[model samples]
Target chain A: MDIFSFVNFFLLPGVVQGSIYALGAIGITLIYAIMRYGHFAHGDLATFGAFTALFVAGLLGLSPYAALPVAVVVAALLAIAIDWLFYAHLRRMPKIITTIASFGVALMLRSVVQIIWGVDTTSYTRGISRPENWFGIRVKPHELVTLLVVIGLVIALHLFLTRNKWGKAMRAMSDNPDLALLSGIDNNKVIAMTWVIAGGLCAASGFFLGLNTELRSLMGWNILLPTFAAAILGGVGRIEGAIVGGLVVGVTEELSVLVIPSEYKMLSSFAILLVVLLLRPTGLFRGKIL
Target chain B: MDWLSFTIYPVYLMIFMCIYGCLAIGLNIQWGYAGLFNAGLAGFFAVGAYTSAILTTSEAAGRLGGFDLPFPFGLAGAMIVSGLIAWPVGKICLRFRSDYLAIVTIGVAEAIRLVAKTEDWLTNSARGITGVPRPLGDLPYAQAQLAYLAIVGLILIVVYLLIERQAHAPWGRMMRAIRDNERAAVAMGKNVPVRRLEAFMLGSALMGLAGGLYVHLARTITPDAIDPMLVTFLVWIMVILGGSGNNRGVLLGAVIVWIIWSASEIVTDQLPAEFALKAKYGRMFLIGLLLQIVLRFRPEGLLPEKLRRAPLSEGALSPTGHGARIQAPHKEI
Candidate 1:
């Protein structure tokens, strides 16, 4: 294949896919850092958010992008409600219990989605758009939008974490929960805030994924391993690391077709996860071991 | 339904209950005794199911088979292969926190599913392997089922007795010590990693045996049979609800959960066609909700682990130390 075709088929799609994985990984890493438990329901929550946006777009007769913020807000609220309903009581128990509980929540969320949406693959728009050629490179409009949105969200998150007081409190809590509480950080509030950010980002990721590819109930679940792979690869808890990890995993998955069967693309991420967990559980950015 | 047919339904249910009993007991060994979270029960179950299917099947053109082995050999092959796979997986993942093990096992299960789906030469791809022989399978339908049930029941009883023996043995006590307090276990000169691996492999072997029993009963195996929801999570709820750390409790749990699960399917099938599909998902939602309720209200389960001695007041049944936080030096962003 020519370089242009390779870039079009492999590099461009990889970057767009990476952006989506990055968005989801950020949510996972944040929740891992703050809650100290892997949220198994995260992928399903993203599915819920994506479907919620689809619902809002259809209801309001607006473009999918116009309905994105509504989905984000709704998902954030749902995240908080779920924590209160299913996870809050388990906080005093082992974190593993909370993790198991999250798996239950995952099943519930997926079933809810299946019940509402009827388990059909769907897209935001009816017709596909052709990629515009720019200096020997081809880029689709939605793909460009996805990258822009991811960049904007990351920049906004970076500013918020570095400048905002609540953000600092979240960092403190993640760094040392007991010390953060000793320093008068309201633990519950910080946790709630963490959910808001994670949930919103999760929605954005799901929305973009739906926009780019068709949405199915299993879409979120299928991508879950790769997203987790990205989180751990970036060294769990490091925002920049998650982004880089997401890009690496995405690109690797896209490029793997050249060497292995396309049916086995998902294996690349699983392999990365195993290798990373075995060699450097601290991740690329030297995140917490847990 | 006719009286004989009706009687067969309960027998069929009992047979499945025995299969799940094996699965639940296996999980109890890992999660209850060793505190090793293996979320990939379906993978091991699949490994066993396919191995037995291939072993006992008369012949096949595309896939690996034609061993035409007996039922006993198939079951044994299943256990041996499943245990071999678990050895490497346990060696690598047992060092991490239970949650990481959960995710990794989930990955392993998915990977296994992928392999089963795509590897046509090995698993016959999506069409799946068929026509595996069953022991005493040539008898009349009712007689065949009864004989199979007897065989499975005997196996379950034997497994229960053996595991119960192990649970009371010194090996079991060492496992509990490691689970309840890893540091203390290590300080006491126990080989924590090796012991954990032992429990993991043993439990996996049991799951494989259950898979073998299931494949023989069905006379066929399919990639779709290895559902994470049905095979993995259901067994988890069974073990948790029955009471981890107690073999008899998990067996009770298996029976109760399997009855509820199968009975709920029957009830949902009675709904109008339009609602029946939705009710299936709704039932899953309820099962998921049931887990939350159990975890919230009765973490110790229906029959709490009966202590031979006074239990540790703090971190009772907790897998890891409550206050043992790993200190990672903070670096400037």
Candidate 2:
């Protein structure tokens, strides 16, 4: 393929989609690091956040972008509530129970979305969005916005983790919970803060996905496996790794249609996941093994 | 409902209960005894279902099947095929903790579903494979249903007896020992990874048996018919609520949860057209809530696993710790 065709059709769209996946993977990585288990419901949490933005945008007659802040806050609170109500009691239990409980939460969250919005595909606004051409490449306004927001969020997160007290505490807890606790870090507060950051990012990812494509009830569930593959492939607990992993997975999947049938696009992410597991279980960045 | 119709409904429900009972029993072996979290219950079930369907179904023009095997042979093939699928997955994943297994299993199930969707020559794609003859197909409708129920019930009984025997066997004790404390079990010369793989494969084989029975009962196999999340989660809830380690409790759980699931659908379907769809989702919401509640309050489930005490030889109890490990029941659940 020529450079223009590759850049416009495959590369640009891949990066746009990659940004969304990166946003979701960031949350998955955070939860995996801080909570010490795979939060299966993270995908649905994104769906909920996106729909929450959609709902508010409808109520206020505002653009979806305008409603982003409210959606982020609401989603973060919902995350905290879910943790307190469902996962807190299972703290002493095995990691598997919490993981299973997260699956239940996924079901509940998706059903709630279905019940509220019905099953039809909906979007932020009703109209075709044409991409503006820049020299040889074309990009949609919303896609550009998604990419910008993701970059901004990642930079902010990097600063927070490196400079902020609570962020450092999160890293410490992730490294060694017992030792972190012994060192006077408030475990509960760190956990709550982890959910806040993860939940907000999850909302942004879901919102961006809705912006880039249309929103459907099953969208989150469908993308969930790939998002997880990105997280694991990047190395579970590493922030920078999630971004690189997401981009690689997204770009590779988009490019894979050249070799394989389009219907089997999803299988690539899984193939990458298995290959990574077999070759290097610690992932590219050497994050947590589990 | 009339007497015959009412009678048939219960029989239908009972047949499903038996099928799911087989599933729960299998899960109990894996999660309950071995502490392996297998989230892909439907994948194994599908392998069994498709394997049996291919083996027993009549000739079709474009598809791969028409082996025209006997029902017993089909069922056995189902178990073996599912076990084979599990073998490599267990080999790779058993080395890690349960969390990794859960993720890999989910991926495997999704991949299997995708394969079934895309592989037209194998599964006939969306058209699916039809004309798979049910056992005793010549009998009257009610009679056929009852006969199939009997067959499934018989299978359930045989599986129950076998698994129950194994649970109380020396091997079963060793499994629980390994699950309760892997390090201690290893110190006592237990090959933890291999034994765990065996448990995973065996449990998957039973799940396959359930799938074979299911396809035979339905008389058709389609990708959509097996709703992965619904079936897998239902089986998980059944085993968890009934008591993971206890075989009898697992069976009771299967019946109770299946009844609730089906009954809710019947009730929800009665709602007006506008509300009916929402009510359907409401049922799902309730089921999910049910899992959280069950996990919170009744973590051991309705029927907790019973502890057993078996005598050990003098040399066998060398570590003195071996006796404590033996007597220390599997309390992790």
Candidate 3:
């Protein structure tokens, strides 16, 4: 097998997974900036979105694609609700305390999903179809869509963060909460907007993931660690960090199977996180300007 | 009394409450008092449990496996070995700030869990060593649990009291100083890193002791037996809810939270099969909701450690001092 061709088999899958990961990482990084702790629940939130999409698909009798937008909206609203009730109150607590609370929130949300959806894995009927040949390398429809979605979302998020006033306010709050408050930004509204945007994005990514692979309640728990690893690797509080870090993780993990057993793919991502932390805890690409 | 004869489970549950309670107190020392975040507590606890189970079980060591060391020695060995493993981790971990340490510690924990699942030579892999001869085989499983509970309970009480003493001592004061503001404490000539290491190591050692006891009581060890995030997060909830710097508060938080979290599981067991299974998760969601609410409402904890206001006499400032380091005026939740 050609090294590049063989690499494609793995690399193509990585991009799809990486895109899904990037979506989740963006939400995670956003949460870290606004909330100031790793949102352990992001994975579950993604799972929740996928589950919600599945629920909508079955209930409305819509195809997965048709129901996708609805699912995303519902999931985004649920994210808002969870934040409104749980996370919003934790702003004053110590960062670690809030983080621990967030873990509790994640656990609770996952448990709720387990209770509501049951543990059975569900997926779209059509799922991602066959791979299309691209330059002697084959990629699937969902994979292609995944790449497209990632690009679109990143561009969309970049526009939101840089161009939009709400995005600027969110960025300002993250940069200096006290200053933002003193400057007369409504912290609560900014916080809610942050939740709304992040939640919406999380839903979209989650739906894409469900499209790519099957959805299970444990899926959220499984990726929770990696989502965190990506966020940490990407400097925990930067969107660009999220994008770059996620791709690096995606490719590194895909490349890892060349040497290590595929069962340990996640370990590769974790290994990257450890090395990053030890060598440059601040992250590889560090600059104040996003 | 006759009508409530199934009261044994409550007793059993109470014992469980104690085991987790001990673990929570160990957490309190590290996270609450010292500001260390240990996400892999479940891993270390599992290590202790497997160590004790293997040392005592005939399946593990065979006839030669019978060091036949008394339970106390077995317990000591369990603690020693687990702490020995934790020592290097703590050393490496203590070199960093809280967040980085937390990320690495969680990874360490995840790695250990997988190792426990895959390490057939040590953990018997998934087949898990069965037929673990109970220390008191004559007693029924239920009765044995109570016995273990009593023993562990006494040990927990002792540990609590000891920590209580330490919390008031000058040494505890120094730890509090370090946790409240690391840079300030360092400016005062405290060895911040060393102080953090001591707290982290001591906490891990106690956690190991709890693990040894947990395995002995359960009489078996499995990879699934320990969930690292649950262990760490649950302890954090307990400590934070009880007031981070307060030993007494942790005890209360641990028992209350354990009972509440499990009560839902017990209730779920009675639920109409499908929904009941789901109820267990309901409890999890509620906990997350609760932690957020609890921290928001009472960041000081349900029974937060009171600010140390009692005067610290100069001569009384030793490790064995009566003041419990918490007596310093420094405030923390």
The DockQ-based CAPRI class assigned to model 2 is medium
lDDT by residue (A207-264, candidate 3, tens digit) is: 8877887888878767766666677677768888887888778788788988987667
> What's the ranking of the predictions by TM-score, best on top?
1, 2, 3
Candidate 2 lDDT tens digits, B1-333: 445655788899999999999999998899989988898889999989999999998788888987999999999999999999999999888877787788788888988888888898899988888887888978978888889999999999999999999989989989998987788999999999899999999999999999999999999988899988888899988988888889999898998999999998898888899998899888888989999998988888898877643466564555533322221123232
Per-residue lDDT for B134-223 in model 3, tens only?
Answer: 556468656666677778889889888998899889878888878766668889899977777777877877887888877776767788
lDDT rank order: 1, 2, 3
What is the C-alpha lDDT profile of model 1 across B1-333, one tens digit per residue?
445666688999999999999999998999988887888899999989999999999889999989998889999999999999899888888888877778788888888889999999999999999898888999978878989999999999999999999989999888888876688888999999999999999999999999999999988888897667657889988988888888988999999999999999999999999999999889888888988998887877887676553467555544443222111101112
Question: Model 2: which residue pairs collide?
Answer: none
Candidate 1 ranges with C-alpha deviation above 4 Å:
B1-3, B310-333
For model 1, how does the per-residue alpha-carbon lDDT over A82-187 read when each residue is reduced to its tens digit? 9999999988677788888999998999999999998889999998798898998999999999999999999999999999999999999889889999999999
- What shift in Å separates residue A150 of candidate 3 from its native position after superposition? 0.9
Better of 2 and 3 by DockQ: 2
Fnat, 2 decimals, each candidate: 0.67, 0.68, 0.52
Residue lDDT tens for model 2, A133-166 = 8997898898888988899999999999999999
Q: Any runs in candidate 2 off by more than 4 Å, and if so which?
A: B1-3, B308-333
The TM-score, computed over Cα atoms with residue i paired to residue i, of candidate 3 is 0.89
DockQ, structure candidate 3: 0.38
1 or 3, which is superior by DockQ? 1
Against the true structure, what is model 2's DockQ? Answer: 0.54
Error of 2 at A217 (Å): 1.1
